[model samples]
Target: MKISRVTARGFMSFDRIDLELNEGVTVVTGPNAAGKSNLGRIIDVARLTVASHAGSQRGNRLDVYERAPRHGTRRFRLAVGIELDQPWEQELIATFVRAAYASSAVELPRPAHSPNVSAERRDMDARRRLAPESVAVLLRGFLVIHYDEGARPRWRASWHHSSTGDLYEAVEPVWIMNLRNGGPLMRVKQEPSAPALSLADAWRRVFPDDQIDARTPMPEQLDFMGILKRLEHPISLRTGAHQDNLPLLDSVRDLYMLLGWDMEDARRGQVDFVHVLDVVLQRACVLTDNRRLPLARTFPLEAVGGEADLEDGSQIPCELYRLKNGPLPLRQRYQRIQARFTELVGTGFDVQATPDPERPGNLLIDVTVPEGDHEYPIAFSGAGRQEALFLSTLLGGDPGRVIVLDEPGVHIEPTLQRRLIQAPDSTTQCLVITHSADLVPVTAPGDLARIVRLAPSHDGSQAHRIGHLDPKDQTRWLQTLGPRDVRALLFSAGAVLCEGSTEVSALGTWWEGSSNPPSGANISLIDVGGDKSFGRYIEFLKAFSIPWVAIADGPALRPASDLHQQMKKQGILTATEPDSAEPDFDAWKAFWAAHNVFSLANVFGNDGTAAGEFEAYLKRLNLELLSQVDKGRSKPRIGAAFASQHPMPKEIADLYALIRDRLQPARLQDAQGEQA
Candidate 1:
C-alpha cells in the first residue's frame, strides 16, 4: 500500500492542508519553510503510527499537536489515505485535544469471573470506557490468515466506533470490530454504534452484503502498551490453551502474535520479525539527509600476529563484515547491492568493507577507484564521490518499500541527483522532499511522476500538484535550459519573458548594477528563444498562473503572429494591424497595458535609421567592440558595454522606469502573501 494523500489541520506550519499524492514517485518542492520538511515529517508520523507501537505509554507520534496550531489554534487532525492496489482507500486519522497527555493511563478490562457473562458484553463494556482517539492506533488494518492452510484468503468489512471509521478483518468473514479496548471481539449484527455508524453507511454503499461473524475469537483485554512490549519477542504464538488471549487487529505482526508461530529458535534467524510482519502493515522506509550506518559490533578473533592483540591481550575480527555468517542469499543480496552502488557512483569506482590491513581485527571500508593505472582508496578522492558512496550504501538493501528521502540531492551533482531518484530498480514508492530543480521533472502528460509545489498561503503552506505542463511550454522550456534555469523560473515571483539571449543578457547586466533589479523584486529573466518560443512560453506562464510580461522586438523586426493570435483570442487585443515600418504604438499600448508587457516600440524611439534589435542599437550608439563581435565580443560583452554607457538612452531609462514601477507593487503583494 502507498499513501495517495495526507490531510492535516493544526499540524506544524499547516493551518489546514490537504496534500494529494501520486503513486510510485512524487517530488514535493517549494521555497524553504513552505513546510516541505514538515510534510515529510507528517509521513514519518504516519509511518511510526503504523510501524511502531507505544510500549509503556500511549503513542507519542501524535504529539505534533503539543504546541498550539498555526495562528495559535487548539487541537490538530491528521488523515492519511493508503491505497491497496485497487479503488480501495484505507484512511488513518489521528485527532489530539490539547489537555490529553501521552502518559494518561487507559485501563484494561478485568477478566469476568462468571462464565454466564458473554465475552461480547465484556468487550463492549471495555471499549465504551476508552477514549475514541486512543483507539485510532489500532484502526490501521489487520492481516487475516486462515488457520486452515488451504482456505482461500479474503477480507471482510465491519464497522464499530473508530477514530477514522476503520474496520480490519482477522480472517475471511471474521471481522475485528470495536478496537477501543486492547482486543474487542464482537459480532456486528445490527447497525454499528455512534462514530462508526457513519463509516458503516459509506461501507454499505460499496459492499452492502459485508457482515461480521462470530467466528473470530475473543480475548481478555490487554493494555495497548502491554501488547506492544509483548510482541517485541521474535515469535509470539497463540496455542490451543491461549485462544482467549488474541492480539489486536492493527498489524500483521500483531495478528500473528495473536494467532500462533511455532518456528524453532526464530529469534536467532537472520530475518527480523518486523520485516516479515510488515507485509500486512505496508512498511515505510525513510532515508533522511543525516542517514548513517549504525556502529558495527566486533567479535573476538584468533590473533594472526602479536601486533593483532589488543592491550588487554584479546583479538577481534578486523573485517568490516555485514551478514558474512548469515544465509548465502543474504550474502548475495549485499553483493548485488554493492554492484548496483558501484554502477550508480560511476565506472571503475567500488566500495569494499574489508578487514583493516595495518590494524588487524579492526573493520575498515575501502572506497577504491582506478588511479594512475592502479587502484587507490577513494578517501583520497573528492567529497562528491565520498558522499555518493555513502548514499549508495543505503540503497543496497530492499526495494519495493515506501521510501521517503529528505534532500537526497543536497550533496550530489545534477546528473547523479537525477539518477539517485530514477534508479532502475526503484520499484519502491518514493516521497522525495527537495528544492533541487534537477530532481523536479517537468513531467509530460500521463506520467507517473508528480510535482507537488508548496507555496505560503495564509500562515500555512498550500500544496499544488502540477499534474501536467503544456507540451508546447515544456518543449520551449527544454529547448535550451537545464534544471537550475527551470527552478529559477518556477521559484521566481514574476518574470520577464523576452525574445532572445541578447535581451536576457542586457536585462541581467542592467539589473545587476541597478539597485532595483527584477531579482530584488523576486522577478526572473527568461529568454524564451525566438518569436515562436516567446508565444509558447507566454501561454505556458499563463497556464501555470505565473505573472509575466513580454519584451520583444518590434513588429517590423520580428512579428509574433502566434502571440498576436493569442492576444486576440484572449480579447486583450482588438485593433487591426497597421501597414507601416513601425507598429501602431497607441492602440497596442492600450491593449498591452492591462497585461504586464511591452515591445521595442514601447521602450525605444525609432530615428528613421534602419537599426532594429539590441546589437543594431548598440552599433548605432558607436560602440567600437562591435567590429570584433564574431571573433571575441559576445552578447554578454555587448550587454555589459550597454549597461556601462554614460547618460543612458532615453528609451533605456524609460524601460527601467516601467519595470521598477510595475514590479514594485507585485513585490509588495508577494511579500504580503508570504507573510500571511
Candidate 2:
C-alpha cells in the first residue's frame, strides 16, 4: 500500500492542510516554525493511534486535545488516502470473500460441474470468478480519525466503490466502519437514526436470507463482533461439509499475522487497523518522531539479539548486531551499511558489537579504522559520524518502506547529505523534512515537483508543491543557484534578486558593515545571473511564498532588451510597442518598480546618464576606491572593494534601508522604540 494524500484540519500548527504525496522521495522544507516538523508529527500521531487500536499493549499516546492549535477549533481530523498494489489487493479480495462464504454469511452461485469433481477445485473456481466483482466493492480506501473536545477519538475507514463501470473510477460509498475507544466495530448508517441497533437485526434488515451483495450500502449500525459470533460453527469432517470449506481464508489470517496483527483478534473479526496502516507506513515513520533519540552507546546483549524490526536509531546497535551475525541475506545488508558509512566519511571502517567485560550481558559498539588498524568505541566518535552511521543503515535497508526522516541532515555535511538522499533505493518512498540545500541539487530535475515548501500565514501553515517547470527553465533554475544562493533564498525571511555578481558583492559588503545587517534580519541577497533570469527566480520564490525584491540594470527596461523579450516570451508582458520614436524609460522603470522590480536608473534618479547602470554608478560614486583594485580584477571584486573602503552611496543606502524595513518590520519598530 502507498499513501497518495494526507489531510489535516485544526491540528497543531495546521489550520487546514491537504498535501498530495508522490510515490517516491518527497522533500518537505521551510524556515523554522513553518509547520515542516508538524507534518511529520501528523504521521507519527496516526501511527501511534493505529498501534493503540491494534495491540493490547498501548504505547505512549499523544493527547489529541492538547495538540489542537491555539485559538483554533477544538475538534480536529486527520485522514490518509491509501492505494493498494494490484497483487496485494487481489489477494485481500480473494481471501476476504472466501472467508465470508465459509462463514455462511454469504452464498455464491454454484459452479456447473460433475459430482465427481473435487471440493477444493470447486472452491478455487468460485474464488477465481468472484475476485473481480469483490475488487469493485473496494475501489478506493481511506482512513480517517476525528477528535472532539468532549468525546473519545474515533476512527472511520471508508471505501468508495461502485456496482457498475470500471473500479478505478468508482466514487459511490460501498462501506464505512467506525471504531471508537476500542469498542466493537460498527458500520456507519447511510441515514440518521435515533439509537444503535443489534448486529442481527441490522444484518437481517440489510441482507435477508444470508444473501450478500458486496456492493450493498452498509447498514446504519451493525456490530462486527456479533456477526463473528453468529457465523461461528463446527466444521464437519465428512466430504459433503469439506466441499464448503475455504482454505484461502486461512491464508488471509496468516497474512494479517505476518503484518503484526493479532491472530486471535483476526479470527474474531477484528482487523488490526494499525498493522493495516503499516502496509503503507512500513514501521519507518518512527524515524521522524523527535522523542526517539539516536542509538545509545551500549545496550544489553539480549536487547541486541531480538528479531523485532528496527523502529528508530536507538535500535540500530541491536540491528547491526543481528545483521553481522545472522544469515547470508542479513550479513549482506550489514556490508551494504558499512559501505554506505564509508562513502559518507570517505574512510573505510568496520562496525562490531563486542561483549562488555565489566558489565554482564551487555554489549559495546566499536568502530575499526582500517588505516590506523585501531578500534575505538563508537561513543567516542564525533556526533556527525554517529548520525551518518545511523542514517546510512536506514537508507541501506530493504526497499518498499515509507521512510519519513525529520532533519536527517542535522549533523551531516553537505557532500554526505547529498549522498544520504541519493542512497535510498527507488522503491523506498522518502518524505524528508529538512533545512539542507544540498539535497536540492541531487533531486532529479523532472521530480522537482516532489519538493513541498511550507510558509506561515494568517490561518496557519500553507504548503506549495513546486510543480514541474519547463525543461529549459528547470535547467536555468539549477544553473543560477549555487549552494549558498539556494540556502539563502530557501530559508530566508525575504530575498533580494539582482542582475549580476557586482550588485550581490556591493550589497553584501554594505549589509555586513551595517550595525544590523540584512543577514541578521534573515534577508537573502541573490545574484540571479542576469536580468533575463529574474522572472524564473521570482516565480520560483513566489511559489514558496517568499517575499522578494529585484534589482535590474537600466538596459533591461528598454523594449528591445533581452530581459524584455524573455518576459514577453514568458507571457508576463503583453503590451504592444509604442508608436513614438523615443521609448518612455522613466515610465517603464516606474511600472516595473511598482511590481517590486527596481531599476538602478529610476531608483537613483539617473535615468538619462551613465549612472543608470549599477557598475557605472559604483565607479562614479567611488572612483578612488575602484582604482585601488587591480585593473584585471572582476567587476564584483571592484564593487566589494569600493563598498568596504567608502560609505554606501545615498541611493544604495536608501534602497537597502527600504528592503530591511519591508522584511523586518518588527525589528525596525523595536530599534525605533529604543532610539525614542
Best by TM-score: 2
Worst 10 residues of 1 by lDDT: 96-105
In the range 1-676, model 1's lDDT, one tens digit per residue, is 5555666766667777876666667887665456777776665554434333312121344344244245544445555554332211111111111001110111212234522323333233333322333333333433221111122211111122222333321122222432111222233332334222221122122222212222435533323322222222211111111222543212222223332333333222222222222333333344354342332233334422222211111121122133333468646755665676567665555445556666677645454777777887665676556556555544554454556677777667888877776663445577778767788755444332376666655446677644455776456545433446755555555678777787787667766666666666667787776665655566545544455777766542222456666665665555554443655665555456545667655333345543546566666655664554435667666666555653456676677677667655445545553322
Q: Which residue pairs clash within candidate 2?
A: 189-220
Give me the displacement of residue 527 in model 2, in angstroms: 1.6
Off by over 4 Å in 1: 13-16, 48-53, 56-68, 84-283, 290-325, 347-380, 424-426, 442-449, 457-460, 465-484, 516-522, 556-560, 567-584, 600-632, 645-676
Residues 1-676 of candidate 2 have per-residue lDDT tens digits of 4566777888776778889887777888766667787776666656655555555333345454354543445677887665555454446544443433333322333334513322243333334334343343332455566666656444432232222322233244334444222222223333433343332233334334333323345422233223323432211100111122344344344455555545554444433233344343444343444334656657776776665344456767777778888899889988988888888887655667677887878887655455465666554676678777777778777655667787788777887887776777776677888888876543357556777887666666779766667988677656545445664467666788888888899889987787878877777788788766777777678777777788888877666667666666556554454432666777777666655667666433335764567877676776666777738889788778778887876777788877766556334323332110
lDDT of each: 0.47, 0.60
Error of 2 at 555 (Å): 2.3
User: What TM-score does candidate 1 reach?
Assistant: 0.61
Give model 2's TM-score versus the native structure. 0.76
